[model samples]
Target: MNNTKDFAKSSWIALVLIVLLNSCGSAVKSTPPPLRSQAEVVSVGQDKVEDSVEKKLENVKIGDAQAYYYYQLAVLSLASGNIEEAVDSFYNAIKLDDKSPFLHTELGKALARKGDLSKAKEACEKALGLDPSYLPARTLLAAVYSGLNEKEEAIKEYEKIIELNPREVQPYILLASLYKERKEYDKALGVLNRWIGRHQNSEVGFYHMGQIYLEMKDYEQAARSFEKAIEENGDFIQGYSALGALYENQKQYQKAAETYERALKVLGDDPRVLDRLLRIYTQLKDYNKALAYAEKLKDMSPEDEEIDVDIGVIYYESKQYGEAEKLFRGYLDEHPENIEVRAYLAATLEENQKYDEALKEWEKVLEQDPKSFDTRIRIGMLLSEQGKHDQAIKMFEKTLELFPDRIRSYILLGASYNQAKRYEEGLQVLQKGLAVNEKDPALLATLNFHIGVSLERLGRFEEALTTFKKVVELDDKHSNAHNYIGYMLAEKGIRLDEALVEIQKALELEPDNGAYIDSLGWVYYQKGMIDEAIRELERAVSLIDDDPVIHEHLGDAYTKKGLFQKAVSAYEKSMKLKPENEEQVQKKLEEARVKLKSQITTHTTGR
Candidate 1:
């Protein structure tokens, strides 16, 4: 709803009535009896004045001139912000000329301004009764109802006004705006469509239609309407901006860029448009264009230091790590307290493999906020990556001390211990994590999987199997659990068919996974399907050529199939690839060589 004070201040109808009364020489008599003081006038409120003013007004002779005199006084009172006097004057005018709808409507407007909506609505209804077709009275009534927040009543008044005068464009716009405010998109569209049908050239109507369609999530129709609105008026900056925003929402970066560029042509050097163009170019990874716009934005908004960070990020995303590091370091040198820039600088340093420098920056962040859990985790992970397992474990333990319920701390600490071959310590850490987060399914599954790995490494086969089964039960689609259980069973020489089924399930989930393929091949070998074993092992070797275990498995399969020469070649390759079972593989290689030599000698002598 429009501000009642602004509406009343801009009331053209009141101005016209004042002008008409003045032209007819119907001014209120200056020497009239002192009716009421300003305090008495205000005290009357919206109630009927039973003061001296009403008694004097009742005694006045009834005529058009007399009614105009009272109407002139009301208009002046309304202009002076004396709502009580205005209401009394308008009521006096209505008593003299009860047939004048304009007087009744004016009375309603004054009462509405005085915070008397009920009486105001009653006065508007009386005006409509006096002259049903009076557009001014109907419009005033609509505004009054809208002010009262009686949306349905206001809509009825607006619709009635539109029915009475279909050619008037204002009513349609007002009604559509009202519906739009109420979130009645269909009704708003209905009103706008009617207006557009009558005034096909109205750019504003088309723009409003586009807004309604956009609100309804009908992107196609909204784009069409926005396009049409622009076609009707090429200088429509708002239409171009809206179209750009719609394209951005749809992820059409190139089109959004073009639309925002068009907006720039119409509104040159606009910072908002430039910012949008920069963002779009950044998303498209067109760094050159993005940098250009970012520079322009920086120049336009020189006080916004965040733009410097944006430029540094663009450099980082473009893989120009040296440039990003330089920029962030320079920015930090001037503003050392900027934690965000310092973090970005640390990331840049880490990306450039300057681990020591990155660690220093992260430590500084800890100084600023010692409770920064994620940063501490990053420090731990970096330490772990650099082979400082002891330091990494200490950092993760410290993180757990600060936040005992942090699941990631437990997971990372367990991983560190496992990486250092401390299986018992890893098991303990994971068990602690499980105890804390037992009810959380995802965390439970992860902890159980890790526990199973630790148990397997510690040679607790039965416990490991039970833990793997628990993982599978927790989440049936855990491919790793199935593969681990299958490989473990096959290695133990038990449950061969069950192992094959589990390995096959794992392979089904990840058809192209080299690890799963290797497990399948190993299971096939355990089941005595030598041809199937060789075929699968060859495929696994082809998929993951560098895995030493796959090479060893292929060598074993070859030896089992009586291909002694091929077995020697496979075993030698496994040894070359740094097999963990170096002694065992050497024994296998010597045996294969001896078998080949013996078979050759026997075949030659017998022949």
Candidate 2:
């Protein structure tokens, strides 16, 4: 055995964040165990070791004196987690007092704790033979059987325990849990129902039933049972949390928040309840409440630096990018090597349009976690966002090379090629993605959409239209495909009525989409609805003012209405924005200027 001095140096536990294993991957509240210094534990443990053996008094009728001494040492060993020594001492105690059922049961418990289940079962059986109604021995035997995966024997023992002690809570709970583990939900429910029949107001039993129903995916029954449990006990924390979680799973944030609030009303500032409120409020975009809970939790556990990351995330989600940036920087100052916090800082900087600074942060994260696929993807996206399409394409192609099974890299690289107008390369990559993701309707739709765009830019109009139609067949609500088809037909001045219908459908799906609105305006212009064309085109410009194409469309609409001065102004604005067809736009601008001059001259002569 190691010296007690070593034991005195390794007892204190450390605290850290508990990242939830939820879809959101959000950090939730966690607290550390109360600090126990090795010195304190050793000091207390030394006393326990020294004084555990009882003094054999004068005629006290204590079972064999040596057995009592060994029993005390066994208990002390067990408490100190010295399982092997505890088992040895327990067996020693039992050998001295062969008929003592308590000693036999204690030995069984030690064996069970040491994971020697077969021996533990034998010892427990010996104890039960000494006293047939010995509850502790029977309980140990049942647990040993369970540990050995002998569910049927465990169930029989539990049934005997329930028959022997019908009013006890644990036997029923244990039996139902065994059945639940085996997915025998009906059996689990039966055990709970049997308990509820005898003890109608058993909140715990009802809660167990609700848990079983939840596993069965009988959500309505789960809710009813949970509600019933809460009605039976207003202070049932488990009931409130479970019901709130159910509502959250259903995306009913308001009702979930209300249930958590009710829990808080009854249970005060319980950490579990507080943490859940933080998550719920964050999801609801109730940043104020989320921050309040975060601050409160920080106050409760000042030593934990993990909460700062979560608080920073809350700010990021709230779109207070400046505040989020500041928080992340401050956290990184203390935890300079924390890749996760640095990544957040990068994202915050990106959202604030500080692209260069964001790139530096992402570079730092990538250097720290070189193999991180997500980090690599983010860096590639940042490059693309800055119109460094070739660099982005190279990065994504490398990502595909490094992680060939990653479908996202193929999609992103294909999109990057299309953005760079490398249409043939984009088509090839997109087709490869489709080949690999044949069964994924959603990915197939996305890849087909990109292929259609490439074909459209390549002037393969019929192929592009067919591909776009295929995207809509895969996903009827694909607004991009609808808009593409509409704009293609309108651009060709053919099927104006069908173009209007397609654009209107796209607008129906995404009413505020500036691109779709511009498509609608162009379709209207094709149909000779010049006034309506101007209205929709102007609305598109208002929504996305930097779009040179929308400006050019507006200029065309003005010229068609013979508003020569307005047409000249719109064309000049389009020229300033550096439209794709610069020479064509310059020609339009010159023509509009000549028309404006002629109109002024005609008006003056008429005056």
Global lDDT of model 1: 0.81
How many clashes show up in model 2? 0
Candidate 2 positional error at 538, Å: 2.9
- TM-score, one value per model: 0.65, 0.84
Any residue pairs clashing in model 1, and if so which? none
Q: Which runs of model 1 end up more than 4 angstroms from their true locations?
A: 1-148, 156-174, 181-183, 214-220, 250-271, 284-305, 401-406, 428-444, 466-479, 494-521, 524-607
Give the whole-model CA lDDT for all candidates, comma-separated: 0.81, 0.81
Give per-residue CA lDDT, model 1, range 65-159, as digits (tens). Answer: 87889887886676566879989998888888998877787787677666676787788799889888877777877866765667798899889
Error of 2 at 212 (Å): 1.9
lDDT of 2 by residue, 72-146 (tens): 777677667787998888788778888987778767756654556688789889988999887777877776777
What TM-score does candidate 1 get on C-alpha atoms? Answer: 0.65
Off by over 4 Å in 2: 1-62, 76-96, 182-187, 197-201
